[model samples]
Target: MPADPAVVDTDCCIVGGGPAGMMAGLLLARAGVRVVVLEKHGDFLRDFRGDTVHPSTMQAMADLGLLDDFLKLPHTEVRALSGQVGDEVVHLADFNGLKTAAPFIALMPQWDFLDFLADAARRYPTFDLRMNARAEGVIERDGRVAGVRAATPDGQMEVRARLVIAADGRRSLLRDAAGLPVEDLGAPIDVLWMRLSRRPADDPEAPLGRASAGRMFVTIPREGYYQCGYVAAKGGFEVIKAAGIEAFRRDVAQAAPMLADRVGELASFDDVHLLTVAVDRLTRWSKPGLLCIGDAAHAMSPVGGVGINLAVQDAVAAANILHDAFALDDAALDERALAVQRRRLPPTKAMQSLQVLIQNRLIGAALSGRPLKAPAVMKLFERFPRLRRIPARVLGLGFRLERVTSPDAFSG
Candidate 1:
C-alpha cells in the first residue's frame, strides 16, 4: 500500500516557481504571511523561458532594495530596439528615453533571476520553497480549493493552505483541474530557438530583428552567444524538419546574413527547439479559494518579449491585494482573489490585444513570404527621435505597472 501523503499546512500555497509564483511568494512572505512555493523542477535552468527584464520589473526590485545587487549579475542591457527590413535598419523603441532606475532592458538568464528571488525570499522565515514538487491538482473541500496535491522526490505530499495560487504556466494543470474557461486570441507563428556563437565583431546591440520577403529572425545577445529565434508559420515544424537541416540552415542564413558562417553550428534539427506561440487568457481568473496569475491566467506572444514583466506585475498586484488577508489570518479570501483578477485584467487584456495586433499585421505578413518593407511607423521614429519613447514606455513600463506597496515586516 502507498504511504500516507505528508501534509504541510501554511497560510498560502503557490504552485509553479516561475516569475509570478516566486515574486508572489517573496512579497507575501516579506509581509509576515506563511507561504509555501512548489516548483516541479529541482532547478530553474530552462532555455525556453524569456529573459527580458524591463524597467517596470527593475523598479519593483529597486523598491525592494535589491536593484543594485540584482544588476550585479551578468547581463546584457539594450538601450534601444531596432529592426532591419530590406537593407534598411530602422530604430523602433529607445529604452534610454524611459525615466526609470534601470532605463534599459536587461537580458539575463531566467534561472539567474529566479535564483536571485528565491535567495531573497529565503531570508524571511515565513517562506517555504519545495523543489521537485509537481502539483497534480487542487485539493477541494466543501466546493472550494483547500490546498494542493503534489508529487515530490521524497513522496506524495499534500499542502493545506487557506488559499491556493496557480501561477503555473500557460498549460497549467491547476487551471485545467479547476475548469476555468480560456479565450484564444490566436497566434499565427511559431519560433525555433537556438544558440549561435557570438563573434567580437558582431553587432554590439543586445537585440536586433531582421526581416526579408517571407522570413523573420531575432537575435538576443548573451555573454558568448546569441539566443536566436527564427519565426515560421504556426504548426509548421514538421514541414521545416522535412526540408532537412541543410535547407533549414539556408533559410536561417537568408533571414540573417550575419549568421551565414555560423549556420553550420546548428548541426542538426536537434539543436533547434520549437516554441508553439500562443495568445490566450482565462475569462475568470479566480474561484472561491483559488487565484490564477501569470501565464496561467494569460499566455502572451513573443512580440515584445514582455511576458516575464507582465507576470511580475501580476505578482506584485496580487501580493498587494491579498497580503492583508493572509497576514491577518483571515480565511475569507474569495472576494480578494476576484479583486486581484479585476485589477490585473485590464493590463493583461491591453497587452494581449497589442500582441494580437502585431501578430496579425507584421508577423503574419512576413511569414506569408510576401515582399516586406519597413512600415510607415519607422519613418516617425526617424523624423522625431523623441517619439521612440512611446514604444519604449509601452514596452518597458507596460500599460499599467504595479508598484511594490506591500509592507515589509523586516523593514524594522
Candidate 2:
C-alpha cells in the first residue's frame, strides 16, 4: 500500500503561484497571516505569459512602499498604444496623461514579476511557498472546504487551512473540484506568439498592432527581440498549420511588413506558440471554505494584455477583505470569500465586456477578411489627442482600482 500523504496546516492555502496567488500570499503574509502558496511548476520561466503591468498594479506596489524596488527590475515602459488599420496608423490610447505614480504600462517578463512578488513574500516569516507542488483537489470537512490536496514529487501532501484560494489559470483543477460553474463568455480569436530579433534599425515603436486584409498582427518591443502575436479565427490553428510554415511566414509578413525580414526566423510551426483564447468567469466565485480568483474565476481574452493586471487586482482585493477574516468562525469566513467575488466581479465584467466587444467587432471581422479601415472611434482618438486618455485610463488603470488595505503586521 502507498504511504499516507503528509499533512501541514496554515491560515490560508493558495493554489497556483501566478500573479494572483503570489500577490495574495504576499499581502496576507504581510498582515501576519500564515500563508502557504503552492506552485505546480518548479520554476516561473513560462514564456508568452501576460506581461503588462499597468499603473493600477504599480500603485498597489506604491501603497506597499515596494514601487521603488520593484521598478529596479528590467522592464520596458509603453506610454501610448497605436494600431495600423489599412493605410492609416491610428493612435488608440496614450498613458502620459494618466494621473498616477506610474502612468505607462510596464512590460516585463511574467516570470520576473512572479519571482519579485515571491521574493517579497518570502521576507515575511509567515509566508511559505512550496513550488513543484500541484494541487489536485480540495479537502472537504464538515460540508466545507478546509484545505487542499496537492501532489509533490516526494509524494502526496495535504495542506489544511482556515480557507483555500484557487488562483490556478483558466483551466483550474480546484475550481472544478469545488463544483463551481463557469459562464462561458466566448472568444473568437486565437493568437500565435513568437519572437524575432530586433535590429538597431528596426522600428522603435513600443508596441505596434496591425489589422488588414484577412489577418491581424501585433508586436511588443522587448529588450533584444520583438514579441509578436498573430491572431487567427477561433479553432483555426489547424488550418494555419496545414498551410505550412512558408505560408505562415508569408501571412505574417503580409500582416506587419515591419517584421518582413524577420519572418524567416519562424522556420517552422514549432517556433510559434498558440494561445487558445478564452473569455469566461465563474457564475459563482465562492463556496463555503474556498474562493476563486484570477483566471480561475474568469479567463480573459488577450485583447489589451490585461489578464495579469486583473489577476493582481483580484489578489489585492482578496487580501484586503480576507486578511482578518481568518479570525472569524467558518460562517463569517465564507462571507469574506464571497466578498472578494462581490468586490471584484464588477471590474471583471466590465473588462470582459470590452474584450468581447473588440473580439467580435474587430478581431472577428478582420479574420473574416472584411475590408478594414480605422474605425470611427480610432479616428476620433487620432483626431483629438485628448480623447486618447479615455482608453488610457480604462486600460492603463482599470474600472475599479484596488488599494492595498491589508495591514502590515511586521511594520514598526
Candidate 3:
C-alpha cells in the first residue's frame, strides 16, 4: 500500500473509465453519489478494441432512453451473422426477430462508444473523470481499503472514497495490488488485427468469417474498409514472422479469396497488432471496501465479441447495489461489494466456460489444420431458423442480462 498524501475525496472512486467504470459512474452520479473515474489514458482511440454492440447493449440504451441519440452516432448494424465454413457457406447466428427494439449488433468504433458514455456521464453533477490518471495501489485505513494512490499527469496524488471499484482491464493494477487471485483458464490462440480497404464491389456484405483447413479469418465492415482478424496458435507469432509478411499476406488471401488483390496492401507487420486473448476469473471479486467488475473480475475471450456487453452489465449491477449504499454512508461496504460479486459471478463463470469451450473445440482445431466441422446443433440452427433463436438469445441477450434498476436509471 502506498502511503497516502490524499488530494481528492469522494463517495466512490472508480479506477477505470472503460464501459463498466464509466457506466457505474454515470448511474451512481445520477443517484447522487459523488464519484470520480480515473482513466490512465487521455483518450479511448486505441484500435482493435471490441466494436460489437449486441442487442442487449442497445436494449440497455433503450431502457436509459438514449437509444435514439446513440443510434445517431455513426455505426454499421449487422442484422444477422453469416460465415463460410469449410467447403460450405453457413448461416450461423441471426439477430432478426429478436424482441429488442434494435435487434442488430451496432458496429461503431470503440472510442466513439466510450465518448458517448463519458458525455452522458458528464450530465450528472456528481461525476468526475480524470484523464491521464493511473492508479498505483490501494490506500488502506486500518483493515479496509480507504483510498487509491495514483501517478497523475501532474504528480503523485491520493483519492479517498467510501468504496473503490477495480474496473481496469484484463491485466488490472488494482486487482493485482489488492492481492486478488486470478483463475487463468488459458486461451489456445491469439489474434492478429489489421485493416484493409473496402471498395464498392465487395460481396458478402455482412460481417463474417472464412475458415480453411488450418486457418481462420474474420472481417468486420467499416465505412470504407474492413477491420480484419487472423487467428494464430498460442505463441505462434514467431512462426508467422519466420514465414515472413508476404507469406502471411498470402495466407490471408487464401483464407478469404475476396480480398486477394488487397493482400498486397498489408505492406508490413507494423500495420498489424497482436491481441493475446485469455478467459479467466478471480477466485474472489471483493474485499473490504473494494469491488472488482468487468475484466478485473473476469477476463473474456473475443469469441462472440460479448466482453464489452458483459462489462457494461457488471456496471449496471454495481451501480444498482452501490449508488444508494454510498448515500446511506454505511460501514458494511465489504458486504455490499460481496453482494455485487454474487450477482455477477455466476454469469461471469458461465460466459467464460462457453468462451473456453469454443477456444478448445473450434479454434484449436482450426489452427491445427483440421477440417472445420460445424457442430450438429449449429447445423440444426442453420437448417431450422427457429433453432437459431436459441443462439441469438445467448449471444445477444447474454445469460444474466442486467437492466438499470436504480432510481436514477437514465437521468445521467
How many residue pairs clash in each candidate at the backbone level?
1, 0, 0
lDDT per residue as tens, model 1, 1-412: 9999999999999999999999999999999999999999989988868999999999999999999999999988889998887778888998886778899999999999999999999999999999999999889899989999999989999999999999999999999999999999898899999998898574555588888778989998888888999999999999999999999999999998888999999989999999999999999998878999999999999999999999999999999999888644334578888889899999989999999988888788888878888889888898999999999999999999899999998787
- Which regions of candidate 3 are displaced past 4 Å? 1-6, 328-331, 409-412
Candidate whose TM-score is highest: 2
Against the correct fold, how does model 2 do in TM-score? 0.99
Ranking by TM-score, best first?
Answer: 2, 1, 3
Off by over 4 Å in 2: none
What are the lDDT figures for the candidates, one per model?
0.92, 0.92, 0.87
Residue-level lDDT of model 2, residues 171-200, one tens digit each, is 999999988999999988899999988875
Runs of candidate 1 exceeding 4 Å displacement: 327-332
- Given candidate 3, what's the lDDT at residue 43? 96
* Tens digit per residue, CA lDDT, model 3, 1-412: 7454549999899999998888888888878888999999989998889998988888878877889999999999887887777877777778888888799899999899999999988988889999999999999988889989888867788899889999999999999988999888999889999998998474556988777789999998998899999999888888998889999999999988888999988889998899998888999998887899999999999898999999999988998887667645446666788889899888888888888988888777777898877767667876798777777778898998888877773443
Model 1 lDDT on a 0 to 1 scale: 0.92
TM-scores for all candidates: the values are 0.98, 0.99, 0.96
Clashing pairs in 2: none
Compute the lDDT of residue 201 as modeled in candidate 3: 75
